[model samples]
Target chain A: MPHKVIRMERTRDHSSARRPVMVAIAGDSAAGKTTLTKGIAAALGASRVTTICVDDYHRYDRQERKGLPFTALHPRCNYVEIMEQHLQLLATGQPILKPVYDHDTGQLTRPELVEPREFVIVEGLLPLYSKLTRACFDIAVYLDPPERIRREWKVSRDVRKRGYTVDQVLAELERREPESAQFIRPQRAHADIVVRFAPAEGHDDTSNSPLSVELMLRPTVRHTGLRGLLAEIGQRTVQLRLIRDEDGIPVDALHVHGYAPREESRMVQKAIWSRLGLGDGDPVATLGDVGNGRRSESLAITQLVVLDHLLRAT
Target chain B: MPHKVIRMERTRDHSSARRPVMVAIAGDSAAGKTTLTKGIAAALGASRVTTICVDDYHRYDRQERKGLPFTALHPRCNYVEIMEQHLQLLATGQPILKPVYDHDTGQLTRPELVEPREFVIVEGLLPLYSKLTRACFDIAVYLDPPERIRREWKVSRDVRKRGYTVDQVLAELERREPESAQFIRPQRAHADIVVRFAPAEGHDDTSNSPLSVELMLRPTVRHTGLRGLLAEIGQRTVQLRLIRDEDGIPVDALHVHGYAPREESRMVQKAIWSRLGLGDGDPVATLGDVGNGRRSESLAITQLVVLDHLLRAT
Candidate 1:
C-alpha cells in the first residue's frame, strides 16, 4: 500500500478523550465519491456527521483560470494548504469559515460556517493527495468507478444539469484525460479501502439489481475489524486468490463478477460473520438496510459488521 | 462608453458563413450575465443560438490555482489570448473545441466541441476585458445591478444555491467587493446598453405596492426607434431615468427595480411595440401579460425591439 496503515487497537475506556474522527472519500470527478460518502454518512446518521466537499476551496473562477500553466486538478491551482488547515481544524472539533463557488455562473460565492461533529467526511478529488491532508482523516476510502462509467455520468450531467450539449461534454472528457490520469488516479494507491460500483457485465441486472460492489481490503488488515460483516458479505465477496501486477507486493483484490446469486451471497456473508463471532446473538438484525436500492442485502451485511465492531470496541 | 460599441447597419443573417458573431455579456460575477443571456438566446430560439460560459475555460483544477497572485477576476490569471483566439473562431460560425470546467466540483473537466449558429453568447466576468475578444462581439451589453441589491442577491444566492450559510456568504462578499468595483463594474461603460434592475421606488400617482419594476437604459436611446411608441412613452419615460450618486454617476447602476400596476407595465410594452410597427398584432399579442413579478418583462421588451429591427432590416 502506498499509504502506511496504522492498526487501530481497541482503546481502554479511560482513553476516551473525545478524539476527532475524520473520514476522507477521494476520487476523480464523477467517480461516485459523493454517493459512497452519502451511504456511509446516512448509516452513521446526520447528527454524528458533517461533510466538506474540497471543491469549495478552489482558487479561480472557471473562466479566469482557463489555459493557465496549471489546471484545477493540479495542487498548485488551489489553496490546498488552507484546506489542510481547515481539515485539521474540523478534526480537532473546531469550526471553519468555508468558501462557496457557484457552479452554474462560475463565481466564488459567499462562504459558509462549518462546525465539527462526531464525524467529518471530506469528499473531493484531492482529499487524499497530500500527506498533510491524509493525516487528517481517521479513515480514508477511494471510489474507483470505471472511466467509461464516469464518462457516461459526466456527459449526462453536463448536458442535462449544466446546460452543455453532448459534443461539449465529450470535448471536456478528452481534455481532462491527461491530468486525471496523472493527478487523480494516483490517489487510489493511498486509499485504505477502494470501493467501485458498476453494472453487472453479461448479466441480466438492472442498475439496482443485485450487482456486487467490490470492496478491496488491504492485505495489512485481514481482520478489517469487520470480519462479521465480511462473513455476512458472503457470495458478494470474490476472494481473488491474491495476485499483484508485477508488484512483488501482496494483493487481496476481490471480484464477485457482479450480479451474483443472492442465496450464494447470503451464505458467504454468514461465513464471514461467523468468523467475527458476533453474527447470531447480537442485535445485528436490528440494523436497517443501508445499500442503494432494494437490492440491499449487502448493506445489511456491512451494517452488521460495522455495528458489531463499533459496539464491541466501545 | 467604456467599451467601443459596435452596431451593424443591418441585421446579420444566420450563416455557416465566415466570421462568427461573438456576443459578449460582461459583468461582475452574479451580475445577471447568464440570466440576461439565457433570455436573449431563448428569445432568438436555440436553433439559432449556441452559448459558451467563459467559466468553462478555467486552466486549473480546484486545488492548484489559489493564492498565486491575481484574483480570477483579473486578466493575467487566465489565458486571455487563447480565449480571444477561440472567440475569433466561434464568431465566424465555425466549430471550435472548447474546454469544460465543473463549477460544483471546481475541476477542469473534458473538452467539448461547440458548433456555431446564428449567434453565440460568450458570458463571464471579464469576457469583455481583453481587446482581442472585444473585436469578436457585434453587440455588447453589461448588467450592473445596484451595489446594495447585488450584495443582497449574492448573499441569498450563495446561501441557497452554493451550499453556503449567511455569515460565510457575507465574508466572501466583503472579499469580492474590491475586485467587483475595479474589474467588473467599470466594464459597463463599454457596453451599448447598460442594464440596471431594482425595485421601483415611490413616485407621484404610483401606488406603494412592491411589484413595480423599473429598467434604467443607459445611453438611453436618443430616439425611441419606433416613433409611435416613443410618443406614448414620452412623459412616462421617466422609467428609464436612473438616479445618480453624489459623483454624478448612476447611484445604483444597472438596477432592476419593481413597479406595481401591471397595466402600466403592459402599456410600456404596448407602446414599445407600437413604435416598432408590430402594433398589437400577432407579434405583440404573442407577448404575455408581464407584471412586477415577472422580472424578465423589461428585458423581453428590449429584445422584442431589437429582434423586430433585425428581422425587418434583414
Candidate 2:
C-alpha cells in the first residue's frame, strides 16, 4: 500500500449550538410511522436530520424465544435499560450498534452499526411507552390507528411477507391483542400528537386506497404556530384535509387517503413547507428544533413562553 | 384514475415425461451446505436449478421462545413433515411459497412465493437425518468439518452476522453440541460422498484451502462405472492414502486433500460428465425400474446392484 488511509470520523454538528431540539414519532406496529416519516424526511432533506426505529433496541433473537411465556411487548422481556441508554447516546449525536430485525426471516440475523446525525425521528411500538424514553423526545407523537385497520394491515403484511398462513396470522393477532392494548395502545395519552390512519367511512375492507391520517395535537399555547404549520401543510400538493375542532381538546387532525390521486397528495405536502417561509430549500431543515426529547423540549418552550410573559410584564 | 394491480401467478416446468431428480446436501450448521450448493448451482446453471434452505421451516417466532427447553435444531421444534412434503413438491417441478429469512434481522417475516424450475438443492443440518427424506435424494453428499474447525467458524459467523457477543455464541454452540452430535453428525453414514474441509497435517490453522472427498462406493457391479467416476474425480483431485490398517476404519488416520489445481478440478468435473454417460441432457428425467423407494436412473444397472451377486456374475 502506498500509505495508510484514514476516513475521518464524523463530528457533531455545531448548528444547534445555541439550543437543542428533538422530535419523536411513536406508534404501534405498522401504524404509519414509515408513511409519516417519509413525508417529514423528504421535507427536511438530509443534512440536519436523522431518524431511527425504537425496536432497533430489542434484546432477544427470534429462535431464542420460541416457547416463552411472556410476549415481546413486555418491558422485562427486552433490554429496555440498554435501549434507553442508546437512545440518549443517539440523541446526543453518537453512534450505536442497533439491533437488527429481519422481518422476512423473523430472526435477528445480524447487527448493524448506525451513526445518528441531527434531526432524529425515533418510531416504533414503544418509543413513548417508557418514562426515560419519553424524556428523550422534544416533540413526541403516537399513532392511534383503529384496531380493525391496524389488524388488517398486519394480516396483509403477514401473508405477503411472512411465512405464516392466514389462519396463523389471525390467531397471533388474537393472542397479541391483550398485550397490545395493555402495553402499546395507552402510550397515546403521553404523546404531544396522536395520529390515526383509518379507512374512510364508506370503504370497509375492499378498496386498495383506504389509507387515511388523523393527527391529534396536545393543547398548548403553541396553537398559532401549529395552525400556521397545518395551513402551510394544507397548501402542499396532497389532498389532505386539516380540520381544527374546538371540542374542548387541544389537538389537530389531518387525514390522507389511499384513494386520493398521487398528484393530490403532493399538494398538501408543499403547504406544510410554506409555514417556515422559505423559497427554494429550507422547509425541513427549519424543523431541526423539533428533535428535542419530549419533557426537555416542553421545558425549553415553556421557558421561552415564560420569558415572553416576563418580558410583557416588565 | 388508473388501477394498480398485484403480480401475476408464475409457471412451473413439469415436462410430464420424466420423474424428477432430487439432490441432497446434508451437513451440520456452518458445514458448507450453502457453499457446496453454490458450486453445484453454478456448474448446472440457474436455468436448471433452484435451491431452498431447510432453516426457513422453523416453527416458532423469536419473541415467542424466550425460556424454551429445546433449540431450533431439534426436529420437534420444526415442522419436519411439512418441509418434506414441500420438498417433494419442489422436486416434482412445482413452485411453492417458500418462507423468507432475513438473517440480519431476527423477525419471522412474510413468505415469498418461489416457482421451481429444474434442480432443487435442499441443504440443512438434518437433510439426511430421516429415512423418508433419504428416499427423496437421487444423489446425497455430507459435509464433515472437524469439531474444532466447525466451532471456530460458527463463532466468527454468529458474532459478525447476528450482533452476538463471542460468549453468547459459545454458549449456544455448547448447548447445541449434544444435539448436533446425535442428530446432525450421524447422517454422514448415509452420504454418497463425505466432504471434509480441514487443514492438512503439519499445516497451521491459517491454511485456507482444504477439501477431502471420501467416496462411499456401495459394493455392487453396476457401479463398475463408479470406479470410472472416481478416476475422473481423481484426475482433477489428489487422493490421500486413507487406507485402514488393523483397526478397519480409515478416516481417523487419513488426510485426503485434492491436489488438483483449479484448472484440473474443472477438467475432472468435465471427465465425470463423460463417464456418467447419460446421453448429455437430463439423465434424471426417467424413473428407471423402481424396486426400492429410490427413483433410479437405469433399470438393468440398478437391478444388478440390488442383488449382492452382480459383481461376481458380471
Candidate 3:
C-alpha cells in the first residue's frame, strides 16, 4: 500500500490531557484547501476544531522569495525545522505561536497562539512533503482538481480577492509549476484520500452546475461500509468501486454525480449523517458552497466520509 | 458472497459453432427490462445480437395465470424445465422455438425461432432464478428501482401501452408483490450487477429531470478498469467506489448523476465508446433515450459497462 497508517509519537509537555487528532489537507495554490478546511471545521464545530495554514511557515516573505532562485514551494524557502517542531508539539496536545502570512499583502504578519482542540486541521501546500510533519496527521488528504479547473479557480480568486490581474496569476502558475511538481504533487501518493472536483465535460451551465467529485480512498484506513446506505437510497448518483491505484495497490473509489437528483442526494446525505450520529439539519451546509447557494453533494459527502473516520477515531 | 460467477457446462451443440455469450437481465413486470435489453441489442448491433424474453416460458396464459392462486411471477406458472433446456441449447449456439407472451392481448401468441448470435441478452421476470438457467449466462443484471419509482413506472407503462386502467395496474402490483418477492427480488443477489433508477429526492420538477442510476458491480465477473477512462474524460459526474455488498463481499459501484450536465454525460458516453473500441459515432445512441431527446447518462453507462463485458467475452 502506498499509504502507510501513521503512528503518532508524542513529544511534548502539555496542560490538556486530551490528545487532539490532526488532519492534513495538502494541495497546490488556490486548490480550495482553505475552503475545504473551513467546511471541515464548521462541520466539526469551530470551537472543537482548530484550523491552521502552514503557508505562514515561509522563512522569507513574498518579496524576499521574489529575489531568490526558488519559489515558496521549496523546503529551504520555509522554516521546515521549526514547522516540524511545532507540529510535534501540537500533536502531543501543546500550543504553538503559529505564524501568519497575509495572503492579501504578501507579507509575514502577526503570530497567533494556537491551542490544540479536539481536532486540528493543517491545510497548505506541503503538509505531507516530509516524514516528520506527516506523522502528526492521523488522516491526510490531497486535493487534486484538474489543472484547467484549478487554473480557472485560482485566476478568478486572485483577481477578485488579492488585487492580481489574470496575467499575473497565469504567470505565477507558470513559474510555480516546477516547484509544485517537486514539492507538492508527490504528496498525493501518500494521502489516504485523494479528492478531485471538476466540471462535467460538456455542461453548458458551467457557472451554475455543481462540480462533480471523484474520491479515491486508499486502504490506509477502514471505511464505514456503505452498501447498506446505498441500498437505502436506491439511486446511482453515488457509487463505490474497488480499483487498483496508479501504484497497482487496491483502493476504493467513490464518485458522487454533480447533477444528482435532489431526492437521491438527500437520501444519501441523511444516511451519512445518521452514520456520523449527527442530528437533523445539514452539517455540511457551508461546505464548498463559498459565496454561492450551490453546494456540491460530492464535496459534502467527501467531508462526511472524513468526519466519519475522525468521529470513530475517538 | 451472494453472487457466484457462472461456469457453463457446455452440454450440447452443433454446426460451425462459436458459442454466443449470454446475458440475463431479470426484473419484475414493467420494470424496464425490455427497454434495457433493446438498448443493449442496439449498442451491439442488432444483427450480431439476439434478444429473448423468458416471460414466454409462462406455462399459463395471462388469463390462466390470473385464475390460479399464484401470480405470473411464480416459478410454477412457467415451464421451468423447458426454459432451462432451451437456455442450455442457446448457450452453446443452438436455435430454439421460443414461446411468445403477448402483453397487449394477455395471450400466448405464435412461437418464434431464435438463432444464437454473437451476443444473446435474455431479459424477463425469472431468467436468473434457476441455477441451470443462470449458468447459461456470462453476465447477469437485476433491475431494482425503488418500489415507489417502479410503481409509478409500472402504472404509467401498463396504462399507456397495455390499455390497463390505473386501478387495475395498482391492484395487480399489490397482488404480485408476494411472488415478486419470492421469485424475482432474490435474483438480485445472484446477479453480477444490480441496477436502480429513481428520481432525485425533493425535486419539484421530477417529471422533467432524468432519473439517476446506481449500479453495484459484484465480483462475479472481472470488469474492465474504468479509472483510465474517468481520467481521460476529466469529469466527476461518473464515479466508481469500492464498497462492501450486503453479503459482506467487496464490490465496486458506479453512479451516474441524473440531471447530469449534458457535457458531463457526453464526456462519459464518449469515454465508454472509446473504451469499447468503437469509433466516433455513439454505439449506444438509442440507449436509455427512451422517449424525448433527454437521455439518462447513468442508464447509458450501465448499458456500456455490460456491453464492455459482452464485447470482451467474444
Candidate 4:
C-alpha cells in the first residue's frame, strides 16, 4: 500500500448534500424524446437541470455503421457498458466526462463534462435498455407514437435539419425496423409511464387536428396525487380510465385530447403544476413546442405529468 | 422507482476479478516522466499495462491558456475534479473515457476508452497533487532531476517535437517557475521513492558521461527485499547509505554510478530481477531507453527497482 498524504482540500466542492433526481425518457429514433425532455428541463429551470442524450455513446458513426451488418439501433453499435457506468455515476450524484456524437456530421467529437444538478433528464434510445440502466432512474418513460406518425416525424426532421433525403430516411427506417422491435420497443414494458401521441380515434390522418396523447401510468412506481388530479380534471378533453396493460395488468390510462381548446389543456397543466406546490405560476409555455412555432396541447399535458412524477420522486 | 426489466445480460463484461495495481509517476514538465513510464510499461508487457498522462485533463487549450493569468500548473487550469474521479475509477479496476489533449495541435481531441489491465501507470504533472489522487496509487514516484538538466531536456524536446521555439520555451520556463515550486515540487514529500538523475558530482558538466541516479527511498512503504539486495551487491559502482532528507528525516539513498562499467550495472540489474521470482532471464533490455536508440544503465537500474515495488504490491 502507498503512504497516505494529508493535504488541505482544494477545488470547488462538488459534493451534493442530496443526490439529484434522475429521469429516463427512452424511445426509438425520432420518438419525441428530446421534445419531452426539453419541456421537463424548462419547467425545472436550466440551472437546476442537466439533460443528456445517451445516443452520444454510439460506437460507430453513420459512415461506419454503413459498413456494418447491424444498424445503430443494435447494442453492438453503442458503448452500452460505458453508458450504464455513466448513469450509475449520475444516479449516485457524481460527475462524468460524457462523449459527444454529432448527429449532423456523424462524427465523435470532443467529450464534455457533465455535473449532475438538482434534476437530471436522460433521454435517448437505450436509457432503459437494461436492468442496470433501469435501476438508475427514479422515473422511466417510453415514447411510443403511432408508427406512421413517428416515421413522418423522422423523415421531416432528418431531411430538413440533418441533411438527409426523404428517400434515404425512408430506407433507413425500413432497415432499422427489425432492431427497433428487438431492442427499442421491448423497453416500453419497463417504463413507469408509456406515452403515445397520435391522431384521435376516427380522425383523418391528413386533417389539421393536433395529435392526442395517451399516458399509460403503471403501478410499478407510486403516482402520488396524479390519480386524484386526473379525476378532478375529468372533462371531455382530459379523461382518466382503467385499462389493461400489455401484461394484462390493470393500469390507469390518462387521455389528453389534442383538438380540445388550448384553455382546457392549460387548466389541466395548471392543475398538475399546482399539486407540485411550486407556487401559482402557470406551467412553462414552451412545453409543447413541435418546431416552427407549432405547439400541441397534448404534448404540454404529457410533459406536465412527467414533471409531476420527477418532483414527487425528489 | 422504475420497474426492473429481466432481460438477457449483454455487452462485454468489464469487471476484473482483481483490481489492477496502480503506480503514480509525478514530475514537472520534461522531467522524464513519460520516458520512465514507457520503460515500465514495456517491461510489464503492453497488454498487461495501461499508461495515461494526467495532463490530458487540461481545461484550456494552448490558445486558451494564453489569455489566462496562470499557466497549466495551476489546479484551476485543469479539470482536477474529473481527473480525480477518473483516477478513482481506474484504481477500482474500472474503465474511463479519458480526454485527450493533442500536444502537437494544442487541441482537446476526442476521448479514448481506457481499460485498466494488470498494471496501470499514471504519469503526468499532477498525479499526486491532491490527497484523493495520491490515495489511488500503490507506488508513488517523483522525478527530481537537477534544475539545469530538466531545463535543457525541456528545451530540446519542446523545440524538436512540440514546435516551440527555443526562446519561447525559455520564457515559458521562467514564467512557470513559481507555480512549479508551489504546486509540483511539494508532491515529492508524498512519494514512496524520489529519483534524481544527473551527472556525477565531480564530473564535468560538458562531458558525455551518462546521467547517474540517486533514489531516495522513504520508510513510508515497506521496501521488502531491497535493503538485503543492496547490502549483497555493495560496491563502488552501486552504494547504499543513509542521508538526511529535506524534512530532516533519515532515508536510504541508493546510488547507481553512471561512470561504472556496463558489466557492473548488468550484475546489479540481474540481481534485482532474480529476486523478483519472475525468471532467471535478465531484466528487460528496453528498460533504459532514452529515445533515438540511446540507453542509460542508471535509468535501467532505477526502473528495475520501481518494477520490484509494483510486483511486490500485487
Best by lDDT: 4
Report the C-alpha lDDT of model 3 over A1-314, residue by residue, as the tens digit: 00100100121112344668888999999888987777678877878998888888887888888899989989898877557756765776766656677787788643555788989899998889887787777889999998888888899999999999999999999999999999899999989889888775567455577887788888887774754565456367777778898789888887777877767776677677787665565754645455556667777777777777677665
Better of 2 and 4 by DockQ: 4
Q: lDDT values of the candidates? A: 0.58, 0.53, 0.75, 0.85
* Model 2 lDDT tens row, B212-245: 4343332211235544444445443544344552
Residue A171 accuracy (lDDT) in model 3:
94
Number of the predicted model whose TM-score against the real structure is largest: 4
Q: In model 1, which runs have C-alpha deviations exceeding 4 angstroms?
A: A1-17, A67-69, A199-211, A220-233, A236-240, A245-248, A263-314, B1-314
lDDT of 3 by residue, B1-314 (tens): 00100111121122455678889999888777877887788877778888888888777777777679998888898877567756765776766656677777777654555788988899999998876677788889999988887888889888988899999999999999988888899999999888888775555344577777778888878775764666456356766788888778888877767766877787777777787765565744657666556666767877887778777766
Question: Model 4, B132-230: lDDT tens per residue?
Answer: 898788899999998999999999999999889999999999999999999999999999999999898788572266889999999887875788887
Error of 4 at A264 (Å): 2.4
TM-score of 3: 0.47
Docking class of 1: incorrect
Angstrom error of the Cα, residue B14, model 4: value is: 10
TM-scores, one per candidate: 0.42, 0.40, 0.47, 0.94
lDDT string, candidate 1, B40-154, tens digits = 5655567877899886655555576665554566666555544764675576554554667677777765445567776677888877775556656666667666776667767
TM-score sort, best first: 4, 3, 1, 2
In candidate 1 the C-alpha lDDT for residue A210 amounts to: 50
Angstrom error of the Cα, residue B195, model 3: value is: 0.9
CAPRI-style grade of the A/B interface in model 2: incorrect
lDDT of 2 by residue, A72-106 (tens): 66665566655665565565555554556666665
lDDT score for candidate 1 against the true structure: 0.58
